[model samples]
Target: MRVADVGEFGLIERVTSRLTYGPATLLGPGDDAAVIAAPDARVAASTDVLVEGRHFRRDWGSARDIGHRAAAANLADIAAMGGTPTALLVALCMPPELEQSWAEELADGLAAEAATVGASVVGGDMSSSPTLTIAVTALGDLGGRPPVTRSGARPGDVLALAGRTGYAAAGLTVLSRGFRTPRLLVEAYRRPEVPYAAGPQAAGLGATSMIDVSDGLVADLGHVARASGVAIDVRRDAFEVPPQMRDAAQALGADPYAWMLGGGEDHALAATFPPGVDLPPPWRPIGLVAAGSGVTVDGKPYTGSAGWDHFR
Candidate 1:
C-alpha cells in the first residue's frame, strides 16, 4: 500500500510501533517532543540531511540503506565530539505514492543502526514532498569529559585514524561504472561501518582534536588545520590498500589513493594525540601535526580535489 493510503498518523503508528527506546529517552513517540536524559549536564547534538538523487538514489540502495546512512552521518558527528549517542530524531519527507512498506523498512534501518551504539529513535515528523528527504538529529552524552574539538591539535601532535577509509568511495566508483560484482565494495557504499566507540576512546586517550571523515580525510583534516592553526601531513605509505579496493580501482582505471584520501562518508574518526602516546587497536598513527596551516600529503598539497564540495 502507498503511504497516502494510510495517512500521516497511520504511518507514524506503523513506524513507531516497532521502535525500542534507550535509557536516555524519557519520552519517545506519541509526544510533543522527546525528553532525553542528560546526566552529564551537557549534551552533544548533531544534525544531517539526505536528499534523494543528490545524496542518494533509490536504484542504488534500499530505503533501509538510506535510513542507516542518514542516521550514521549524524551519530558519527556526536561521536566525533567525544560523546556517546543516546537518541535520534528523524524527519522524513516523501512522495505520496511512496510505498508504505518502504517507510517502515526505513524506520527499521534507523532503529537498527541506533541500537548499535545503544541509542534509540525517540521522535520524528513526516511530510509529503516531491522528493524524498531524511533529516536526523542525534543527541549524545559527554560522560563529563570536555569535547574533543577541531581547534585543540598542536604542533608535534600525532595524527591518528580509528577506522577504515576509502572503502565506501571505492564502492561508489564500482557502482557508478554500472558494475556490482564486488559485493563488498557496493555494500560499503550502501552502509558504512562507523567506529562509534573510537570517538570516546580517543577522548580518553587524550585526543587533542578530532573529526569524522565524512568529507574526505584531507578535506576534513583541513578543517582541523585551520581551526587549530596547525598543519597536518598525512603519510602516503601509512594506508594499507585492501585487495578489494586495489582490484576495483584497477578495473575502473582509477587511483585508489584518490578515493582513500578524498572520499567521504566512511565516518572514520581522525584524531590527533600528543607525542609518545600509545594508540590502541584500530587507532594507528597516520600522520603528524606541525606549526603551520593547511593539510598536505607526504609534505605536499594534494593534487586532486581534496574532497566533496556540495557547491562545487
Candidate 2:
C-alpha cells in the first residue's frame, strides 16, 4: 500500500511498533521526546541528512540500504568522538506515493545498524515531502573518558586509520557505469562497514584527535590539520589497494588512489595518537602529524578533489 493510504499516524505506528529499545532508552517512540540515559553526564551528539537523488537513488539501493547509510553517517560521528552510541532520532520525509512497505524496511535498516553498536531507535518524526529525506541525530556516552576532538593533534602525533576507504566511491563508479560484477565494491557503497568499536579503542589508547571520514580522507584530515594547527603527511604506500579495487580500476581505467584519497561516505575513523603508541588490529598507522599546516600526500599537495562538498 502507498504511504498515503496509511496516512501519517498509521505510518508512524507501523514503523515504531517494529523497533526494539535498549537499556539506554528510558522513553522510546510514541512519546513527545525520547529520554535517553547519560551516565557520563555528557552526550556526544551528531546529525546527518540524506536526500534522495543527491545522497541516494531508490534504483541504486533499497529502503533498508538508505536507512543503514543514514544511521551510520551519524553513529560514526559519535564514535569519532570516542563515545558509545546510545540512541538515534530519525526524521523521515517522503512523497505520499512512496510504498508503506518501503518505509517499514527503512526502519528495519535503521534498527539493525543501531543494534550493531548496542544503540536503539528511540524516536523520530514523519512528514510528507516532494522528495525523500532521512535526517538522523545520534547521541552517545563518553563513559568518563574525555571526548576526542579535531584540534588535539600535535606535531609529534602518529596518524592512524580504522576501517576501509574508497570502497564506497569505487562502488559508486561501478554502479554509475551500469555494471555490478564487483559485488564487493557495490555492497560497500550500499552499506559501509564502519569500525564502531575502533573509536573508543583509539580514545582508550590516548588518541589526541579523531574524525569520521565522511568526506574524503585528505579533506577530513585537512579539517584536523587546520583545527590542530599542524600539518598531516600521508604515505601513499601505506594504503593497500584491494584486488577488487584494482580490477574495477582497470575496467574503468580510473585511478583507484583518487577514490581512496578523495572518496567519501565510507565513514571510516581517522585518529592521531602519541608517538610510540602501539596501534591495535584494524587501526594502522597511515602517516604523521607534523609542525606545519594543511594535509599533503607523500610530502606534496594533493591535486585531486580532497572529498565530497555539498556545493562545488
Candidate 3:
C-alpha cells in the first residue's frame, strides 16, 4: 500500500509498534514530548539537518549511506555537549517517488550508527516533501554533572581535540572527481564516528569549555572564544590529519590547509582544560585560550571562505 493510504500518524504508529522500550525510557513515543529519566539533573541535546544535493548526492551515496551520514551528524552534536547519547529523534522528508527499499536501508543505516554511539532511536517522524530532508535530534544525560558549555575557558586553558578532522573535506573532493572513494575519506563522509566517550570523559576530567567541530577548527573554537570571552589560538601542525587529504585536495586544485582549517562536518571534539587537568589518553593538545576574544590559527586569523552557516 502507498503512504497515502496509511497517512503520517498511521505510519508512525506502524513503525512505533516495532520498537521495544526499555526500563530506562521514562516515556516513549506517543505524546507531545518524551519524558526521559535524567534525574541525574543535566540534559545534553543537539539537532541538525541534511538536505538533498547540499549535504549528499543520491547519485553517489546509497540511501543507507545517507541515513548513516544524517545520524552521525546528529550524534556528533550530542558528543560535543559532553554527554552520553541516550536516545535520538529523527524526522525525515522526502519526495513521493523515493523507493520503499531506500527508506528501509536508510533505517538500517540510522540504526547502525545510533547503536555504535550507544544510543537508540527512541522516536521520529516521517513525511513527504518535494525534496529529501532529514532532521535529527539527539538527547543525552550528563548524569548530574554541569554541562561543559562553549563558555568557561580561562586564559591558561589548553585547547584540545578528540577525533579526526579534514577527512570529510577530502572525501567530498574524491566524490566530486568521480574517484572510487578513498577508504578513509569515504568512511568519514559516510559516518563520522564521533568520539562519544571523550565527551563525558572530558566533562568528568574537568573540561572548561567544549564544542564539536561541525564548522572548521577555527570557526567552532570561535564559538567557544566568543562565549568564554577569550581569544583562542590553534597550532595547525599539532594534529596529524589524514594524508589522503593532500592528494585528494591537489587533485581538485584545493588547498589542504584550507580544508584542514575551514572544511567542516568532521564532528570532532574541541575543549579547553586548565593546566594539567589529566586529560583523556588519546585527546590531543591543539591550541590555547587567551585573555581576548576571537580565534587565531598558528598565530594568525584564518581567512578561509568555508565555515558553516546557511546561505553564507
Query: Best candidate, lDDT-wise?
Result: 2
lDDT of 3 by residue, 155-248 (tens): 9999999987788777777787788666788767777767878888888888998888887878888889999999999997885656677667
Predictions: Cα RMSD each: 0.8, 0.7, 2.2
Model 2 Cα shift for residue 243 (angstroms): 0.9
Q: lDDT of all predictions, in order shown?
A: 0.92, 0.94, 0.78
Model 1: residue 228 alpha-carbon error in angstroms = 0.5
Clashing pairs in 3: 230-292, 231-292
lDDT of 2 by residue, 194-256 (tens): 999999999999999999999999999999999999999999999999999999999899999
Candidate 3 ranges with C-alpha deviation above 4 Å: 1-23, 30-35
For residues 1-312, write the lDDT of model 1, one tens digit per residue: 999999999999999999999898999999899999998899999989888878888888888897888888999999999999999999999999999999999999899999999999999999999999999999999999999999999999999998878988888888778888588778888999999999999999999999999999999999999999999999999998988888888889999999889999899999999999999978999999999899999999999668887766
Segments in model 1 whose C-alpha atoms lie over 4 Å from true places: none
Pairs of colliding residues, candidate 2: none
